[model samples]
Target: MQPGEPSARFVDIELEPGDLRLRTLVPADAPLLVEATSAEPGRSLWGPHPLGPHSLRDAQAALAEWDPAAPGQFSLGVLRDGRLLGAVGLIPERPGSIEVAYWLRPEERGKGIASRAVRAATLWARDGLAVPRIWLEIEPGNEPSLRLAERVGYRFEQRVPRHCRAWEHQDADRDTWHDCLIWTFGTGPA
Candidate 1:
């Protein structure tokens, strides 16, 4: 669906599976956002915007900028027992596709939280939004994210060179880029 479509309304929707609740992030989550992102600095570079919020004020600004109602694009807080664990974001890539990006707290990794959260979001995008393709762009060295993508049904597609602008090289006179492993959902292992 295109932006502003009637079915793009996802701002108020909440995906609750078992004890996990995926809901729209709010300003109140700034502290958790800062805390979670601070544990691993590189986690910020995985999103569409390589530079993620680092301070509470920055987190608040990031939360405020997230528009869940904007067709096929949204960031949802992954909460368990009302406490923020991480976030799952669906960013529109094209007319019928979206990219799924997620990150969990350091302590929350390896507990199946990311898998469940991704599955929930993917299901929503597939059934709720009628989105046909869902994909992920993971850095090659990020083993955890690579494993999680496969475990959640996203198959490795290809590696695109210079897919993302290096966050650390933003000020360099010459361009510096990084490769990203593309993984797409709804296909068997490659």
Candidate 2:
């Protein structure tokens, strides 16, 4: 990563398949943020501490903070026919691995939008960024997420106990933690 170089290849990438598209997130997407947090405000692992209007501000601030050339952890807005469907993020967690995070609006679920988005993102990370491995951490019992990962070619490796908690439950008791399944995309099954 250089001072002015982008952390990922999202800048040159514009994924558009069918009516769906994935583009680097911008402040203009703040309204979409508001729409997204309407149903589940203050609940996201990838947004502000309290996900809401305040989170929108936070997201805006984050976008402003980045130099655009070298974005660190970046979020991309998922849109269909010019409407926001959800968001996906690429976070370089370590040297050889990048974490893939995504979510879709309730109305957007079950439409295969998320699956398409994940597949596109992983492909970008693998080919564009030359990422050796991709990781997706999902809370236990989240069948949809698990299935999405599986459908996109990720295989379950192990469960990390208390690795993370739902964003809404962050203030709950310490024992109230989410057992996340660590799924990975690598050369072969782990």
Candidate 3:
């Protein structure tokens, strides 16, 4: 990829997604990271996550010793003029398949940022990584997110029942389940 260009990875598919730049996630983004994590009631809705401030320093410290191209679990920071809008990441399911996920700040909602980010990711998964399918897991109540998956070239392929538990929103033992809407795109950019 050219300078300022995103990689073929799910998080950096766009060769040059103008305005918004996909940059390597650095440890110094701890404060902004803290803000985003604390924006929602739950740090994350997919699984058991901390309910308060995150180990920003520790996470950043760890990133310092890691390599982005090492192998698995790649995460990228979505930035616009150095401001953190959100993040995009890839979670490999197996040898030739992976799941893509992303999150944007509440204030950045309705700005098409998620779709662009997903598009970049989709392109990477399909073209760069040579992956066959890309799945996006969204909460049942997140209508905007659900629509976003479709808008970005993903369609509802299946409804995974009780796929996730929002341990923070609902009681940990309540079995607060969320349906996972599966979306897919072409062999290339979705």
lDDT of each: 0.72, 0.70, 0.63
How well does candidate 2 match the true structure in TM-score terms? 0.79
- Higher TM-score: candidate 2 or 3? 2
Model 3 pairs whose backbones collide = 10-121
Candidate 3 regions off by >4 Å? Answer: 1-18, 26-32, 35-41, 44-48, 52-55, 58-67, 169-175, 186-190
Candidate 1 yields a Cα-based lDDT of: 0.72
> What tens digits encode model 2's per-residue C-alpha lDDT throughout 39-79?
66334424535654335676566555432345467777787
lDDT of 3 by residue, 65-178 (tens): 322545555666677766777777666666656678786777787988878877876776677666776778777778988888878877776678878666645555765767
lDDT for 141 in candidate 3 is 76
For model 3, the run of ten residues with the poorest summed lDDT: 2-11
Please, what are the lDDT tens digits per residue for candidate 1 over residues 47-166? Answer: 434354467776776765665543445687788777778888877777677789888777788999889889888877777777778899998898999989989988889999878666
Q: Each prediction's TM-score against the native? A: 0.78, 0.79, 0.73
The total of clashing pairs for model 2 equals 1
Model 2: per-residue Cα lDDT at residue 134 = 87
